[model samples]
Target: MTRRQAITATATLGLALLLLAMGAAARPLLVDEHPLSRPVLNPTEIGFAQDMLAHHSQALIMTARLDQTADPTVVALADRIEATQREEIGELKGWLRMAGASTVNNAPMQWMHPNNSVTDHHHHAATPSETADGGPAMPGMATQTELDALSAARGTDAARSFLHMMTRHHYGGIQMAQAANNLLTDGIVKQTARDMMTNQTQEAALMEIMLNSLTTAR
Candidate 1:
């Protein structure tokens, strides 16, 4: 080929390459403006995080209401639950914040039963009367009346109440965690849910043994 023709071909190729580079650089900007940009967390993950955070918050409240004079073993269990759940709450909050989601879930338990048409009328902070009237927004949660009884008990009675209430609470939490683990493909939240299930299952078993012993002694 002639030198002039070869130079013309090279210049044409260079121009095409530059245009491609510019288009590549501008592509992301266009994508950022699109209405269907990818989300950091899917609906299931966000719902799980929000619901679990509320569940963990309730556990903390239960722990706080435990009578100080309860059995040493019972007190220790309450302390451990308080500490572990508090840390988990922090992790859940961080995930929600990163995803730009509200900390509270207006429609609790929707993630577990997506087809059930669970509406936003269910609040995480249900009134005590509402819970006592057999309307726990989530499974395994204690009614406000049950909590009040726990708060009012003392010594062995307090221990008994706490063991019973927390055991049920843990079972509910386990149910949610198990659902989350199964629903999530892979992520920090999935792993956390698995860990929660394992730990809470063990704790529930321990509580049952404790309850049986207390019953036998009584």
Candidate 2:
């Protein structure tokens, strides 16, 4: 209320605003701005980014299917899944763009183990017919056959199959997310990946909730 007190209050407010602006400017950017922290991705970063995009796409597609097919539980779960994955898709693309790569150079299978010759049990999702002459499978993609089967189901059959496929789909998502969290050394990106796995692992439980609903509905 006094003049001196008012002056001091204004000074404090101005100082706070100036500090806030400086803090924001200090934050890292994907391009131009120096990265807040150096990248820890190495080879697996590509695999992580590439496959996770594909995985997110499939999740979007499956969620879209559930939306169109008109299942309340599936639709609810799908909305939740879609919201998370799409945001992550933006982050992944940002990484790719910042890294100056048009595509992930390694095969999707390589995401499993870059150093060792581990055989992939998840290979059937990408057949020769689906790819361009023996290249690494598109990161996180599902096969056309699987897509067709999902499209063909109706009512409870459709709902049940969606639950099963989505369960498997979630496992794949968690793998890619967890791999980044466990392996990546970059602080911010690793933290982001860790946050993603934290959310996805929780979201994965929604599939189980959907399953129980479907079972009760039947």
Candidate 3:
């Protein structure tokens, strides 16, 4: 309308734009730009991944040692177990790598008991074969002697030994997975743990039934 009025309106718009720009500048930047914002695994997640990797590795070893002449059902179960564990191992390793964590853990099973609190019945004093981090041997892990026995056995004996050992192994894995699932609030790792618990629990039950049938057939 008037020149003075137009000038006043223009100044007010400029001031509003300046305030908006300042507000945007004051906001926090994206976390991707910060070093601390990089993906970090909590102690529980790191421990689960590392220990489970070791556990799954042993399962592979057991499957590799299985006698080819064993029962077809037993052989098939071993193959399935190997395949599942191998895929999970890859995922665990990927997560660990993304977090810049070591794939191998010297101190195992610490995640189950934070702050020296141990209430699990499965916890046992460390044996000479598996003493790590001043803690007990991981539950359900076969001793070297047992593994050697399984390696030496053949045919039905091999299947029986494998079924027994793997059943126990699955039990241990279920325990660890359950613990991880409980400890983690919510994340990919937690979901992975829950899946492991379900899968391993079912496997263990099947193994038990197989073992019973094998024994009865003998």
Q: What tens-digit string does per-residue lDDT give for candidate 3 at 66-168?
A: 9989999999999999999999999999989988899987667778787664443345553323543332357777777777888899999999999999998
**Highest TM-score model number:** 1
lDDT by residue (tens digit), candidate 1, 1-218: 89999999999999999999999999988777557766788999999999999888889989999999888999999999999999999999999999999998887889887876776434444433245356447867777778788889999999999998889889888989999999889988899999999999999999999989998999
After TM-score superposition, the amount by which residue 91's alpha carbon in candidate 3 deviates from its true location, in angstroms, is 0.5
For model 2, the local distance difference test gives: 0.68
Q: Which portions of model 3 miss their true places by more than 4 Å?
A: 1-38, 117-122, 126-136
* Superposed Cα deviation of residue 82, candidate 3 (Å): 0.4
Model 3: how far residue 41 lies from native, Å: 1.9
| Candidate with the greatest lDDT versus the true structure | 1
Rank order (by lDDT, best first): 1, 3, 2
Off by over 4 Å in 1: 1-38, 119-136
In order, candidate lDDTs are 0.87, 0.68, 0.85
Among all windows of 10 consecutive residues in model 2, the one with the lowest summed lDDT is: 127-136
**Candidate closer to the true structure by lDDT (higher is better), 1 or 2:** 1
Q: What is the C-alpha RMSD of each candidate to the true structure, in Å?
A: 4.6, 13.4, 4.6
Clashes of each: 0, 0, 0
